[model samples]
Target: MAGRRNGHAGRPRVGVLALQGDFREHAEILERLGAEPVEVRRPEDLRGLDGLIIPGGESTAIGNLMVHSGMLDAIRSFFYQGGAVWGTCAGMVLAASATTGPSQPLLGIMSALVERNGFGRQVHSFEADLEVKGFDRPFRGVFIRAPYFEDVGPGVEVLAEIDGRVVAARAGKVLVTAFHPELTDDTRFHEYFLREVCGSDERS
Candidate 1:
């Protein structure tokens, strides 16, 4: 799972899809973690990146932008080539193979079914400490107009859940979180994705 080398001085280059979402938040977090984060607005912006982050936003809007920009296939191809992808909130919806409550665009990267805004409206947003599989301590999860998985495929590994509801999962090199981990100070999730999913060296 070695990242495709882009000669960025040996640091792994991660791209944050900037079409419609809190892409800047994710990019800032990546920079603080010592990884170069590129804001990707076009399909060509995806080239030579080690990994990608699809941030939370309006799912339909992001999907429409992706299709219009002709980046849907490029994203799917990147995952097929062993690249790590982390999708949060609306991103979770985009990565799923199937979704509930009317159809939307999907990259079909992960074998799961998601229900958009499963956590209710923005007014119902909440925060909770999540017990993830590989984490020793609970990770703070910020749910803002989040989505949850109703069903996961055989290959998917459920990571974090709240009240028996699945909120985080991973399949192959793909990682998905229903809440916004980027909104918090905790960097464990990002470290896990880089070291475990992408097989890249974790920076201090």
Candidate 2:
């Protein structure tokens, strides 16, 4: 484990995919939450990570980078070996089994059919208070060119939604959000991923 190797002991070492997007924001959050945040730019960076976070950005660009960097198959193998993952916004698009509109490279780890930019264009971006499952209060969801799930296969648990559209969901150790939580001050989503998904006991 990275924590043990890096002398962090019980702290979980989480990797943030840095190929594109607001990876710095995610890294800051993970660091503030007491976990070691590692920027994963290559397939070899996946080693010893307790979990991975795919940040919000251009899905097609990020997908292309992953393919060229040999990170596609590497991440798949990491996931199958019980690695936890959380995908936000465009990351959700890459994580889904299939997407509407354009054909793009995907991790196909999450069992959901997603509609890219299902909300609208960038100008239509907006925020909403979402009632996320397992949370004591509503979460402020920041939707920027967000995508929504048309459907999720069996075993996938819907976490939050807006206007009856699925905005957040999870299957086993993998979590996905149509909105950006790192953009907001609330760290509940990150905390949940650390404590619940990664099985980390560290309290933020």
TM-score of each: 0.93, 0.93
Which tens-of-lDDT digit does each residue in 120-194 have in candidate 1? 999999999889998999999999999999998888989998877789998877899999988898989888876
Kindly report the root-mean-square deviation of model 1 from the true structure over all alpha carbons. 3.3
Which pairs clash in model 2? Answer: none
Q: So what's the TM-score on candidate 2?
A: 0.93
Distance from true location, Cα of 148 in model 1, Å: 0.3
TM-score between candidate 1 and the true structure = 0.93
Q: State the displacement of the C-alpha of residue 73, model 2, in Å, after optimal TM-score superposition.
A: 0.9
Model 2 agreement with the true structure over 75-185: per-residue lDDT tens digits: 888877778889999899988998877799999998889999999999999999999999999999999999999988988889998887899998877899999999999
